[model samples]
Target: EVAVLANQTTFFGESGGQQGDAGVIKTENGAIIEITDTQKKLGALHVHLGKVTEGDVKVGDAAEFRVDHARRSSLRANHSATHLLHAVLRKHLGDHVTQKGSLVAADRLRFDISHPKAVTAEEAAVIEADVNSLIRENSEVTTRLMTPDEAIELGAMALFGEKYGDEVRVVSMGEPVANEHAYSLELCGGTHVKRTGDIGMFKIVSEGAVSSGVRRIEALTGADAANYMSARENVLATVAADLKAVPEDVPARVKALQEERRRLEREVSDLRKKLATAGSGATSGGDAFKEVNGVKLALRSLDGIPAKELKGMVDELREQMGSGIVALVSGDGGKASIVVGLTEDLKDKYSAVDLVRIGVEKLGGKGGGGRPDMAQGGGSDPSQADAALAAIEAHIAG
Candidate 1:
């Protein structure tokens, strides 16, 4: 292990929220060991974890290792973008914002900052825009080693509880000729892009409160950000085409649909009440009334009436009929709705739930249960509605 640690390597180990470099090591004898991860421990010791995929590797063997450059570039871009995002948050949300923690990965970045309140969507958009603007400026990212006091004097932000030696590495991104204090300056030891422009693009994918007074923002940089935007645009286009409207007019079209739906709902409700009144007039005396086993019953099948209106219809029937078992079946298409209501007097003799169950069973459906005074159920076969009502009537007679 010490021999592997002692080997002179150009690969950078994991530090400051950035991932370690990954690659493979080849021995002089053509043996290969895959280096999955590299981490720094005990000051400057680079611990490498790997498996020997080829021949045996002994102590003190000479080996050549290659770092994954593409992966490293991605890490560098995301890491640098975190710094810019931090600066932007502090700028837009006021200096009360401070870095809490972060995770800088090759594919995405997460930044945790201390803020009193949750970030709003508008604020997140502004912060993202500011970060992207900084990337467009292509500010020079510079790193320097100085005393902790000197770094602090330059307004370099330091992490809480982090032990810093006399010499600290300070990372700063800015065009000093414009404003030295304008960019992000922090004490960090992670790898980063050489210039802000290297990030290519910046986007905040999501933001939320991670803890009390701490908010987290997850984002993508470079091609990842561009790809996310492209995919979102494609989804919007598909939705617009489905609605037969252009993307710019989609919101208005959706709003119009909602209004139309509400208007139709009111109209349907009015028509149901009118129809119920007309049916009551036609059968008010004795047309739909019958006597089964000495119990008065009123049975009727109505068409195109919604299940939601069945309860109201049952209520109206209970009020007018005074005493009886009212079984009403109404439906359209292939669906059927059955509602059974018993007057106050008949509720003790028979259960409304039992009546509804009889109807639903004859119609070959499930999910039927309710109270004694009123119960409702639905079935898929509307054509069987007549048989369902007949079954209920037979049950009452028997």
Candidate 2:
């Protein structure tokens, strides 16, 4: 059974890679139930699913739900604050506060709001302060169902691709006067608390991007802000206890730790590069053990060679080894790999892909293709590696 999409508030865990909002719904009889997950389907409306009902419940049962109080409060703290951030942007960065996407989870809220240039730290601080003041004032937030034309007349912003019926919900924040100049008015179906005051505190945690065209931000609200601060305090306490130093000195200790980590990362990266260069092969011609048609060929087991890189190596080897072809098969346990390289003169005479198929078949397994110039294949059989190589060489010789 399905319910009206309008009644069920969905989460922003939608297109932006943000997690769904976790909350709860209240029934008509005052049943407070947990809202574990919220999702959207085909841009209709957010769907809310929760705990199973005890008695048999029908699809059309009339119910009124509130967001999980704590989580929804946190979300409101972040969501409303994001609006202030937009206002501040217009003040400082011009009229480019288009929201790309947003996530208002209980722990933290992320906003992918846009601007041409990066917002300076000073500007960010001003925006944060503006939002904090709004939270401090505890502004009232109210929603009403209005005709689409009426909503636009009231200056409500609607998103593109958001399908609307004859009527839409317009959420307004600030004094409840019939035509008061409110802070924000938008068409949304997500769960939000009744008042801005419900949001305890707000902080802009970080700002970044969703894509090249879209800027992004993350903020903390309500209990999440408190929890984040508390967690940092606990860390500071632990550090002070361990070092026998004041909590204020933890900053110096953290800077030193960060420097050490950077040093280790640089060292590891350099070592990896050196090893890759050292172990990779550049072996030239030594002897041609077999001649296929008029082409000279050699066979051997190759190690530490991935298929892509080996093609270049095979080219150099082919020039020196002979004018024909050189194919190598490497295998360990049940897995086997093969690479074949050929010269331009031999394209019509042989196909590298064909060679791979024959090689895998000879090894009692399966494989596939590539161009006549270079090809690679794999199969299940380590024992088949050497035997398959030898069979291909012999076939060429005959």
Candidate 3:
């Protein structure tokens, strides 16, 4: 642990929803200690965390400290962009816009604000355009130390739930308006870019409702934003090529393809139903029967037949067979579904549920319960379908 005095250190601690600065400290003995994180305690002391990988690092040893410039630059870019985004939101959404929460990372930033509804796509586009306009203007960023009352008098915004001392740090961006105040002036302690143009660019990647009356905007800046836009362009180009259409016509092409798919689906379903009735003597499937105790036992397995059409098939078969029992099983792979239908005469003697339960058991499956006239059950193993059908016949025979 290395203690960092206020003005003696250049690293900024983790605060204001922003990550801490990371760097390394080179000791007198040529040993290097990596400082992966910096944090400020309640007592205003900065603590640096890392381990000495080389020679021993003793306390009170003078060391050369350095902060990772690239990482700090990215964080500073995103942090300053967050302030501009807040201002843009307030300008478009309403004066009621207040910061609910925020997270400033090197790759992206998330800003939560008070809003009654989700930001529409049009509103988001306008807000993003407004922010990029400020970036293009290259507005100046100013920081000053002033009393809290004085900062508030200048219309500086203070975050809710934040504890501020009598003396607070005020950060402002953009030129002074008629009120002699910058467009965005907030009582913040986080590090920021020297000018709005230093942010390079700003883009809102997503917007959504986080909670009741609260909305969140996730955005990226600088190289991160550039990379995001490049990736999206590549995806759109690929999709357009696949659709054989220009980027502007891709949506219409996709809609046409979907309509074609639905048409093909309906045609295939009708053809399948027609083919099923060809030799089956019914829409469900072809039925064969065996005589058992003066009752006709009709059974057939309708492979690939939908469950919805199974009942109609059984009913038609019962009408043709007239005085027997109908048992149908259908499905694919290792799954099976069985339906049983009883003739008016057999309904009084043998139960359809009992026959279905006995059939499912042979297939190592479950489910069978209904009136004596009709019942349905399913099995996990389709390999035993033949044996299950035989079991159904034997159950009725006994």
- Where model 3 places Cα greater than 4 Å from the true spot, the runs are 1-7, 175-180, 209-213, 275-300, 304-328, 337-362, 368-377, 385-398
Write down the TM-score for model 3.
0.79
Q: Residue 183 in candidate 3 has what lDDT?
A: 82
In order, the Cα lDDT scores of the candidates are 0.84, 0.65, 0.83
Winning model by lDDT: 1
Off by over 4 Å in 1: 1-4, 40-45, 176-182, 262-398
Where is model 2 more than 4 Å wrong at Cα?
A: 1-72, 82-220, 225-294, 332-334, 364-367
TM-score of the candidate numbered 2? 0.52
lDDT of 3 by residue, 1-398 (tens): 44444345788889989998888878788888788888887747777777776787776777888999999999999999999999889989999999999999988999999999989999999999989988988988999999999999989999877889879999999776686789889999999999999999999999988999999999999999999999999999999999888999998999999999999977866675444334352222354556777788777755776666667777776887788888877776557878888988877798999998988887788777778999888888766666777788777778
Question: What number of backbone clashes does candidate 3 have, counting pairs of residues 3 or more apart or in separate chains?
Answer: 1
Where does candidate 3 clash, by residue pair? 280-286
Cα distance off (Å), candidate 2, residue 8: 20
| Deviation from native of the Cα of residue 233 in model 2, angstroms | 11
Q: Sorted on lDDT, highest at the top, how do the candidates line up?
A: 1, 3, 2
Candidate 3 lDDT (Cα, whole model)? 0.83
